[model samples]
Each structure stands twice: as C-alpha cells, then as structure tokens.
Target: MIKSRAVIARGKGEPVEVVRIDLPEPGPGEVLVRVQACGVCHTDLHYREGGINDEFPFLLGHEAAGVVEAVGPGVPDVSENDFVVLNWRAVCGQCRACSRGKPWYCFDTNNADQPMRLEDGTELSPALGIGAFSERTLVHAGQCTRVDPAARPVVVSLLGCGVMAGIGAAINTGGVTRGDSVAVIGCGGVGNGSIAGAALAGAEKVIAVDRDPKKLAWAEEFGATHTVNAAETDAVAAIRSLTGGNGADVVIDAVGRPETFEQAFYARDLAGTAVLVGVPTPEMEIKLPLLDVFGRGGAVKSSWYGDCLPSRDFPMLTNLHQQGRLPLDKFVTEEITLDEVEDAFAKMQRGEVLRSVVVF
Candidate 1:
C-alpha cells in the first residue's frame, strides 16, 4: 500500500479536506494511475453535497488525465507509462448495450475490484469511480483511455467529463451537420463545449445563451456566432431571431433547469433536435404541453456523457487539440493544487472560471 494525499468529503454538506489515505496495489483488471491533472467539475460538488448519494467519505475528482503507473494481472488494453484520460464508463463487452454495438450506453461499467481506504480502514467511494484528486488512483484498465502524450494533461483532462459531454451533445446527440444553426443554453464549460463542437462540425451559426456577460464572451472565444443574454431577453425569442426567425436547427440545454429546457424546446426549428445535456435534480420536473410535444415533430434527447465512447472520442479530440482545430486549452481558466479545490469550487459556482484544473 502507498499513502496518497487526496481530497475527501467526509460527510454530507461538510467541507472537503486534503487527507492522506492508503492506496492499495492494483488487482486483476485494474491499473494504478499517477494523476497529472484533474478538473474540478460540478459533479464533484454534487457528490460533496450528497446530491449523488449517501456515500460518505467520498473520494472526489473524476475529470482527469494521467500516466499509468502499474497494471494488474489480465490487463491487456493498456500498459505502464501510457498517457490516459480516465472515463467512468468502462464498457463491458458482454453487456446488453455493448452486445447491440452501442458500447457508449454500456449499462454495466467497470471499476477497480479493490478499494482505497482511510487510516481507520473505512473504504472510500470514489466519485464517478475515479477518485483522481489524489496523486495516484486505481481504476479498471478499460477506464483509462490512451490519448496523445503530446497533449497537455491539464487541457485534455477536461475531456474526461464536462467538455466531452458538451461536445458529444452537439456532435453525436444533436447530429449537427455543416451549415446548420445551433443554439446552446448555459455558457458554462459544457455549454461552451457544445458551441465549440457545433463550430467544429461546420455549423454556420452557433448562438450562445447565458445570463453572465463574461461567460457569453468566453462563448464567443469557443465559436459562438451570436450571444443571448437570457436574463435580459426571452431566450426562445432571441434564438429564433438569430436563426432567421425560424429557430435553430439544433438547440441544446446545458443548464438543466425546467425554464431553460422549455426555452430549448421552443427554440428549435420544425423537425430540429433539442438536447438536454444538463444534469437536473430528482425533484425538478418539466411540464410541457402534450400537443406541443407531438406538434414539435423532432427528437427530444437526453445526452448521457455526451453519448461518447471514450476510446474513440478521447484520441480524436486530443488529435484535434494538437492540430489546433479544437481549442481545448482555452477551457482551462486556471490551474490549482489540491489544497485550493474549495476555493476553486467557489470560483466555479460564481462563474469565474470555465475549469480550474488541479495540477499534481
């Protein structure tokens, strides 16, 4: 066992602390990774607030890029020294989703067989099955998708979650094509990712909607052709106005609120796609007119992790970043240490940063 300092949320609503924990050696089908960088994502904050579960003493942090330090028995896909981005969905080939050839929807994902424990021997529940806020973490071999070593870990790590989700929402879920008009609600990391993805997919116009002017400006950098200050204007009306009074070809709601979702639903042209990429709470519900749903004549989709297959998307995105086609680096608003995660969370909540990466 090795001692690694990691951020731990001991209880519901408790402040996270950096503490030393016992990290065990990799078991079968597992790999030990030395995390180079991890992004402070909202999901980690959700886990801390017990919004995810009652899993206390939670080992937080999941959006990460790292180097494989060790591989356990029967691990064949990756080897030591491989540069990788961690993914929560390590597809099981035998699962129903994988059997149907949609491994991205793999129902039975894999995690490490063993656990990292505290000094008192309490097992830690890793956030998204990848507790990467530490110097090192153990995960299923399949969870570590190899990517270009030339790419910066701090930038590519965002691909492990939010950025990937946003990009996937636009490209995969939305099926955005060349000359399409796309509008993305919420201008945070995921929303900017959708904007970028739409641009990368050759969309003629990408509209960004947000209440924060700073975030809207950032959206421009990510390829938004127009901005809608939702706080000042009717978002649905503004989106329609931007797209020749016909609404966008694809509209994505990155803010999971009912109001924003309603805006997205109404902001798409006839037969156009409306995607929900935001994570909404359990009690939060939407009540749309049944006639509107039938009259819309388009798909209403919920994007799960951007409908991405990490093994396929991670390398492709890394290559795009390396080629300067995808501005992945622009997502890194700041770099911090593990100790500053609490402050980073505050910055994130205040919309001060797109992503505050923790560099080990």
Candidate 2:
C-alpha cells in the first residue's frame, strides 16, 4: 500500500481538503500511475457539487498525463516509465456496443475495482474513474494510452478530456472536413477545441459564439473565422449572416443548455449535423418544435468523450502537439499546486480560465 496526499471532496458544496489516502498495489489487469500533471476541469467541479451523482467522498481530478509506475499481470501495452494520458473509457470488449465494433460506445467501461481509501479507512470515490488528483492512482490497464515521451505532461494532459472532446466533436461526431462550414457555441476549452478541430479538418468558415468578449477573441486563435457575442446580439442571427443566411454546414453546441441547443438547432443548414458536445444537468430539458425536428433532415447526436478511441487518437494528437499544429499548450492557461484547486474551482465558476493544471 502507498499513502499519498490528495484532494478529497466529501459531498455537494462541501469543502475539498488535502488528505492522506491509501492506494493499494495494482491487482489483476490494473496499472498504477504516478501522475505527472492533472488539469482542473469543469466536470471535476460538477462532480464535487454532486451534479454528476450522489457519490460523495469523491476523489477529484481527471484530465491527467502520467508515467506508468507499475503494472499487474498480463498488461502488455504499457510498461513502467512510459509517458501516458489516462482515459475513462476502459472499454469492455464483450459489451453490446463493443461487440458490434463500436468500442467507442462501450457500455461496460470500468475502472479500478478496489477503492483508494482515506487514512481513516473511508473509501474514496475517484472522479471519472481516474482520481488523478493524488500523487498516484490505480486504474484499469485499458485506461492507459501511451503518448510521446517528449511531450510535456501539462500540455498533453488537457487532451485526456476536454480538448479531445472538442476535437472529436468536430472531426468524428460532426464529420467536419475540408470546405465544411462549422459553428461552435460556447468558447471555452471544449468550444475552442472544436474550432481547432474544424480548422484542422480544413473547414472553410468556422464561426464561434460566446457571451464573453475575451473568449470570442480566444476562439480566433483556434481558427474561428467569425465570432458572435451573444450578449450584444442574437447568436443565431450572427451565425446565419456569416454563413450567407443558410446556416452552417455543422453546428456544435458546447454549452449543453436548452437555449444554446436551440441556437445550434437553428444555426445548421438543412440536413446538416448538430453535435451536442456539452454535458447537461438532469434538471435541464430541451423543448424544440416537433415539426422542426421532423422537417430538419439531419442527425441530432450527443458525443460522449467525443466518441474517441483513445489508443488511436492519443498518439495522433500527441504527434499533432509535437508538430506544433495542435495548440495543446494554449489550453493550459495557468499551472498551480494541487492545493490551489479550491481557488481554481472558483475561477472556473466565474469563467475566468480555460484550465489550471496541477503540476507535480
């Protein structure tokens, strides 16, 4: 067993604390990771607030890059000292979706079966099946995806979650390609990623929509050709005007609210795809005109982890990072110690940062 200091959230709105926790040795098919860096993601905050579920005593933090410290029996893909980014999708091969060759939609994805416990013996629930807030964590072997050793942990760690979501939303879910006009609603990390993905896919015109002027400007760096400040004007109108009043070839709603969803719905060309990349709360609901749903001859899809296949996407994205094409480094707005996560959460609530990474 190993004792390490980690961030632990007790319940909804409860405070997070630096507490000692016990991480046992890796069991069968498990790998122990010595986390190098972890990003402060909105989803972690959501998990802290119980917005995700009532699973309290949560071990917070995901979006991590690390070095494999130890491996259990039969784990051949990753070895000690390998640099890797952690993934939540520890896909189960025999699952209904995986059996159909769609491992991206694996329903039986899993994490470490044994819990990391607090010093007092309280088992802590790791966030997103990762729990990278700690100095070390145990995860299913399948969750480990090797990346380039030359890549910096702080830079590549962002791709473990939010960045990957945005890129995959545009590339895989939205099917963005050369000459496809794309619009992204909400210019946060995910939104900016979508813009970058569209640009990488060679989208001719990429539109960005957000209420914050600063975020709108940030979107431009990610290849947004047009920006719409919803605070100053109707977003749908701006997107339409930029797309020659025909709506965009693809519209991705990164905000995940019913209102933004409606905007994405109306901001797509007829028969164009609408990708909902943002996660929504249970209390929230979307009520669109039934007739419009029937009249719009396109797919309305929700992207979970951007429908990514970690083994394939991680190395490719890391190469993009190495080649200086993907601005994975830009997604990291700041770096802080794990102790600063509480204040980081506050900044996230105010929409003041894209990410505040915890560097070991």
Best by lDDT: 1
Q: What's model 1's overall lDDT?
A: 0.96
What C-alpha lDDT do the candidate models reach, one value each? 0.96, 0.92
Give the deviation of candidate 1 from the true structure as CA RMSD. 0.6
Q: How close is candidate 2 to the true structure, as a TM-score?
A: 0.99
Candidate 2 off by > 4 Å: none
**What TM-score number comes out for model 1?**
0.99
lDDT (Cα, tens digit) per residue for candidate 1, span 1-360: 988999999999888999999988999999999999999999999999999999798999999999999999999889999999999989998988999999988999999989999988999999999999999999999999999998899999999999999999999999999999999999999999999999999999999999999999999999999999989999999999888899999999999999999999999999989999999999999999999999989899999999999999999999999999999999999999999999998998888999999999
Clashes of each: 0, 0
Model 2: C-alpha RMSD to truth?
0.8
The pairs that clash in candidate 2 are none
lDDT of 2 by residue, 1-360 (tens): 888879989979987898889999998889999999999999999998899888789999989999999998878888999899999998988999999999999999979877899988988889999999989999999999999999999999998899999999999899999999999999999999999999999999999999999899989998999889899999888888998998999999999999999999999999988999999999998898899999988888999988999989999999998998988888888999989999999998898998899999
